[model samples]
Target chain A: MALTNHPSETPNLSFLKEKALQLRRLMLVQAAGKGQGYLGQGLGLAEFLATLYHYELRYDRDNPEWEDRDRFFLSTGHYSIALWAVLADIGYVSKESLPTYGADESPLEMSTIEGRVPGVEMTGGSLGHGLGIAVGAALGYRLSKRDARVFVEVSDGELQEGSTWEAATAANAFGLDNLVAFVDCNGIQADGAMVVPIEPVADKWRAFGWDVIEIDGNALDQVVGAMHWARMARGRPKVVVMRTKPGKGIARLEAREKAHFIRVGADEWDVIAKELEAENA
Target chain B: MLKGRTLGMGELERIEDRPFRTAPFAAGTLAAATRCDRLAVLTADLGKYTDVHPFRDAHPDRFFNVGMAEQALVSVAAGLAKTGWTAYCTTYGAFATRRAHDFLAIACAHGGAAVKMFAGNPGLTTGYGGTHQAIEDLALMRAIPDVTVIDPCDATEMQQIAEQAIDIPGTVYCRLLRGNVPVVLDPATYRFEVGKATRFGEGGDVGFVSTGFMTERCLDAARKLETQGVRASVLHVGTIKPFDAAAVAEFAGSVTRLVTAENHVLVGGLTSLVLDAMQEAQILRPMLKIGIPDRFIECGSVPYLQDKYGLTAARVHERVAAWLDRSGTSAAA
Candidate 1:
């Protein structure tokens, strides 16, 4: 199947990987500005966010509210740092607004608030809510006969919420083939590691009757390929189990303990950015 | 079992065929759906119970049953609204408020989605016990910022409110009463406004402030008290959240005594609202609250529950009469 609305005519893995590095650099700067934020999850899903926003998703940066644009819902709202980075790179938001994130009176809040930002579809600080709302929007699109699809990014830690399963069941029951869910399994939550262990997560979605695809989320090719496969699938909802490292690019941040909410000192942020730039070079 | 009373299989069939107060909701929604294609009817497996089966049947493509998941029901409705569709969903009041309150608050209210949530079996209207009843729903919904809280009194009011709620932008939580509802107010003259209370009768002795189905009971009590030489004015408050405090204060200023009645707990419902309004306006007078006290009511038949909680017209009349006798407030000529 042809990759619809891809930024490049041919599959350019190098360019896409560069885009991911750019997003990571932007996220690092945003987090460092706030002194603390959801840096780990944002860095981990950089490739997936870059692949979806730049390559796979069909969105008009000039007019974010265009009627027939594909919707991307960030279920793990703490990952607003990643979303704001992607939105700025795509011109949906100003590059200067990145530093004001998580500050008072700034629309670019720590968590995503719908309508406050251009690309944000819904407010998602509360876990287990995004997939259900995505299901509703998918159903709405099907009823309206709009050829737009909805891509929702959820966390593996969010699987603990009962409402997530409830939404999964309804998505399959309604046969929402237009809806695709990306479960970012970084394996780290607010209270340290997964206390109870929500392993075998792929089987859970498959049991709920979704077209499941597991992939290494940090790999640019696998993230883009899985999205294409999900868009081509029919007769059921789709889920891409994105198993990724908590900190993807930088070696120092990846090895650091307690990667959930990373608070690097002002000098350490410069080292992290230089490490990312050298690796890309 | 009782003398000359139908029981067993016959009683079951009779109750099943009994007309519910929620019929207007189904009929009104179906009527509204015909005109607006953007209208979608959704329920959390409460199609038959909430009387939304007709809309589901008519607009099968637009109808969605999200199983018994109230959280998904609310979140999905918010999602549908975000896509520029006016979505309406219904479920038991207990489930809507207690189970999926966060979703309703975040997805629908805070997001400012045009989702209308019609919650049924408010207060003592259900006989399935305390778990099935939602007594504190008004208090819970009223506390949410920017959510329009409505409690329709009867079938006509329910129909009018259900049709108009779709046009009222933002999230709305409307209390619904189903099964064998009474028609109390005259549809010809009664105008349903969002935050305005309508005065039913005039009197200078006392003001009978009421909301929801209890407004019907208060109207009856006012008529009965007229024969006893007590001129009691009736003010029916339908919208509870953006409450018409001015109308309430004007009505209270004209009367010597004030009595607040409701089909809910007296602590945080209409009585509390009227008391706050009176305090804000500094219009203090002799007041008596007649409704469920500060306690959890036991399960029983609707009539038994109504009488036990002093929710009936006769009970309201009795309470007002006793208070008048004690205060010696003379009747208005």
Candidate 2:
């Protein structure tokens, strides 16, 4: 009964775009401040987070624990920097929180602090977990006859975990139409590309009885369109394969594996700041 | 004990009046009633064995049997949890502990996925041999930081604890059994409370703290000891994760000798928990462990293995007496 379907009035797209840029800036700064972070992963996932928090997700910014709101699970915990940037940009936490990325004492431990991070539905770090939790949440909503959707952000490498497929099989079997999974198919994992290749990802999802869609994740409109279609799909759960570029906005990091782990020197902070400002301009 | 409940296989077949039982099945029912929208029932081709078939039948749209893949069983449950579903994945205890530990620990527990696992044939309940027995489940689950562990005494406790599991914030791995479960504790005498030990008998000579199916045999041993004018205390501990060291230590400090009984390996589970508690509380009494040794048990009858492993009432009585004699404590007359 605590679950609700009271949708909020749509916000302006211009504002969301600005928020995305700000999030990118925050993430870049956090990575630079730490001298190292999962900058590449966060960059790749920035647009997905932007589209979710800004336009698609049903959440109460002021009251993160609102029972009826959509549950967003980030299964790959290394992308905490990206998630932190999104949370800060969307006012889930203050922008000031960004400086503490990878700090020893901060509550932000470089892992997605599920439930603790205002909009994060579950804690994530260990891969292959979100799908089950999201499955449970979707079932909870369905049992209550609520229309709230559950969205899980899974990485390409995470699919190697048998648990993700387990959830996928069950989601289809259960006809969880309200559940959606956003896969960041950036190709790169901890050690080079995922083994055995994860291409034709959409085909695999469709074979598992899901309503699958593929989109260029960096494009805001495409991301939004996929979300719209996913919401409209009936019966089967939806999976949006987001093809993204690692280290998206930063030109230098975009091509380097260093984007995967960019460690900025203390003396190079000024140079990095200047470059970020130029990119923003 | 509750009887005459049938175990249904899938959507197609139904077995009649078999007296099905398990903690997760009972908990699944309560969860089904409470989180009606977000709750889902899942099994790894083990709907009847783990006793989740009832929930599946009631909520067909919300129930799924994901074939016989144990790793997939928990992962899919974790995925459902990710997508806003509170999924209960059930399977045999042996499969859960040995096969899908990564899913149970990382995906469900460490990932903070709200997935519940109901493992069947926990610690010698199956009588089906080593392949089915879950002697190391508690040890496997104990390593996860945020996961909750439960071992119900019988059908009544199973039913009550099932409802209580929803209150636990993260992944829960519960020992389960199905069909014709016996009632070990009176409903009026003991209430279902996770993390709290239930003291069934009072005594000062020796105390037996146990978990899983072995608790039932230990209680019987306590009764047998009483008939011989020996007052032995019996404590049933169902929750093993946040192992209640303080309570175990207090009981150990008061008793002349201590013993731990479980249907699991003595290296981990009840015996290990008791030793850990004693070490932490600094109460090192002459402790005797009554359970399977650190070796795979050969296929045999349930009673035979119980006797072979010293898990029967007679063995418990004999072991407690031996320990008492060594400790120079006389039986209460």
Residue-level lDDT tens digits of model 2 in B1-333: 223322221111112432334333555465555655567777888776666766766678777787777766777677566555676777888998898887787767766777778777777654556787788888888878898898877766777666666567779888765555666676567687778887876786678899876677788878877776777788888888777777888888887778888878877687888888888888877778888788876655565566667877777777777667666765443
Best by TM-score: 1
- Worst lDDT run of 10 residues, candidate 2 chain A, spans A1-10
Kindly report the docking quality category of candidate 2. Answer: acceptable
Angstrom error of the Cα, residue A91, model 2: value is 0.9
- Candidate 2 chain B: minimum summed lDDT over ten consecutive residues — where? B6-15
The iRMS of the candidates, in order, is 0.7, 4.0
The per-candidate count of clashes, in order, stands at: 4, 56
Point out where model 2 deviates above 4 Å: A1-17, A269-281, B1-41, B57-66, B69-89, B99-116, B127-130, B163-171, B200-203, B226-231, B241-247, B279-284, B318-333
Q: Write the per-residue lDDT of candidate 1 for residues B151-231, one digit (tens) a residue.
A: 988877888887788788799999875545566766677768899999987887878999988887888889888877888
C-alpha lDDT score of every prediction, in listed order: 0.85, 0.74
